[model samples]
Target: MKIAVIGTGYVGLVSGTCFSEFGHTVTCVDKDAGKIERLHQGIMPIYEPGLDVMVERNTEAGRLFFTTDLKEAMEGAEAVFIAVGTPSRRGDGHADLQYVFAAVEELADYISDYTVIVTKSTVPVGTGAEIIKRLEGKLDEHLYSVASNPEFLREGAAIEDFMRPDRVVVGIDSDRAKAVMSELYRPLFLNETPVVFTNRETSELIKYAANAFLATKISFINEMADMCEKVGADVQQVSKGIGLDNRIGGKFLHAGPGFGGSCFPKDTRAIVHSADDYEVPMKIIRSVIEVNEERKLAMADKVIKACGGSVEGKRIAVLGLTFKPNTDDMRESPSLDIIPALQKAGAEIHAFDPKGMEEAKHMLEDVSFHDEPYSTMEDADATVIITEWNQFRALDFGRMKDLMKSPVLVDLRNIYGKADMTSNGFDYTGIGR
Candidate 1:
């Protein structure tokens, strides 16, 4: 298979690289000349575990290439994936589809043969039909087909998810499109990975629904954590009790600062907007969005309360900045809300993350960055674990106590036990217990 993936953002880069690793020839195209140049020089625009090594090996094997020339990349390609970002619109919360539509319009001019155009970005339902309508007079009807193949990769574990997906959901209106897509995923077929075939609208809805549902789970557990705090019960035990059931199997049930990053926030908003457009109200999803926003903002109060009802003139140490670890993405991170609120409450912030400090420097204001976790704790009034990066799991309690002005620890992710922190002679507060 010869494939061209447009807009070399996270999904485009990862999909193109992984496709090449599946023994397909892939060329990733981006409009940004600097980004293309960086890719050629073996530099990645974003961080993902194991992605750089995979890109290197595939490029060395002559299976993957990157370029800024879209026409050149599309030449002789059997499939073109439009994996551009679909961020939420400013006011209406609808998916801003200008990028995806523009790519399709530009791509329509360069198709020379029968090609399958797949939407690998998470898009709203009926987007494929809109694309087909856009290309109606611009190109011959028989020359190309548009399909929806939404990505479901997690940020920190994208490569593993791409290679070993739970299932591949593809939506197509024609036999020709289905065949091309099937052949493109033949390797997965050989591995007996289930490839779900459905209509384009259904496929698009699947992505949004899955994300919104997962967001609901986070909100549910967070609400449970709040209830547990009031009732003098441990949310961890509550989560375990419910998660033991096969039907409610544990995933995204961890009580934390709420869901953030690229997918959940934007997708949930887009879906809620889409439902509104159809004159249908998605009340539960709407509540999920409301709860998550409130949760992020409330974390600052959690820290403030732990610091004796005021953070005035206090230096608080924050352990994580990225929404979740293993990626440097700072979009909608809980730290974005918590840190700024803490600063507003007169708390000077010291923060550290293994990979996110560089990006966080741009997003965060007036916060001192540290070289290591222990350095972040130096002379701080209280320490808060915002993201559960691997390194923060096991810490030298004695050293942490020695570094801090006051021995106060707030574990937002519930990474530590109450008994352990109490035994260590520190004032400890966790999410639910």
Candidate 2:
């Protein structure tokens, strides 16, 4: 299959490259000339594990192509995927559809043959209809069918998720479009990844529902974590107890500072807003949003209290900065809250991450960046672990103690056992324990 993935953002790039790895010839389009140039030079704009190697191999094999030409890229493409972003609109919480619409307009003008125009971005229900309406006039109506095939790729593990998805949701009514989509994902079908065939509206709803459910789990655990703090009970134990039940499995139940990334925050808010417009307010989801926001701020207070009360003149070494490990994405991360609050409390902050430093530098201001963990902890009064990177676990505790002015560790991620740290002559704190 010759595929054109428009908009070389996270979704587009990953989708295009992975499609090439799927034995399809793929062309990735981006309006940004500089980004295109960098791609041509084998330079990646974003950090994702195992992506660079695959992109390099595919590009060298001429299976993957990157360009700024929209019409030229779409020329003979059997399927064109609109993987553009639908970020939250200003003030309203509705997904801003400007980018997706703009891509559709250009794609409509360029289709020379039968093409399945798939929406791989997370979008609101009825967006497929809106797209068909907008493109039907200029588009070759007989040759193109609008399909919603929402992507469920997580940032840090996107390549793995894309290559081995649990399910593929295809939204369409036309048998022709369904057949083509099935063929496009035939390899996955062979591998037992179910192709969930459904209508466009239902598929869109699934994306929102999946994200909202995941957000609910995180928020639920976060609230429980707070209660555990009040009653001197460990939320980790509580989660383990409930997780043992088959009804409530143990995924996404780990309590953390808060949930933040490219997807959950925006998707949850947009779903809530969608429910609101229909006069069906999701009260539980609304509380999830509020509780998540407050949780971020509360983590700052947790850090303050962990350091023997006052943050004044304290040097805090933050051990991790990314939302989660294995990627450089710093968007909406809990570190966003923990850092600023620490700074406002008159604490000098030093931070280090294996991969997130470049991105985090712009997001977090007035913070000193260190080359290594031991280096970051040098002379710092306390250490706080924000993201659970592999290197942060099983670290040299004795070396950490030697470097830090005070041997206090606030492990927000629960990476280390309290007993181990206590016996090692350090004060260690975790979310619930």
Best by lDDT: 1
> Model 1: which residue pairs collide?
none
> After aligning candidate 2 to the native by TM-score, how far in Å is the CA of 23 from where it should be?
1.0
State the weakest 10-residue window (summed lDDT) of model 2: 135-144
User: What is the C-alpha local distance difference test score of each model?
Assistant: 0.95, 0.91
Per-residue accuracy of model 1 over 1-433 as CA lDDT, tens digit each: 8999998899999999999999999999999999999998899999999999999999999999999899999999999999999999998989999999999999998998999999999999999999999998899989998899999999999999999999999999899999999999999999999999999999999999999999999999999999999999999999999999999988888999999999999999999999988998999999999999999988999999999999999999999999998999999999999999999999999999999999999999899999999998889999999999999999999999999999999999999998999999889999987
Task: Tell me how far the alpha carbon of residue 93 in candidate 1 is from the true structure, in angstroms, after superposition.
Answer: 1.0
Across 1-433, the per-residue lDDT of candidate 2 in tens digits comes to 8999998889999989998998999999999999999999988989998899999999999899999999889888999999888999998999999999999987787887899989998999889999888976697688889899989998889999999998999999699999888888988988999889999999999999999889999999999998898899989899999999989999899999999988999999999888887899799889989999999998889889989898999999998898999888898999998899999999999999999999999888999999998888989889999999999988998899889999999988999988989999998888876
Off by over 4 Å in 1: none
Clashes of 1: 0
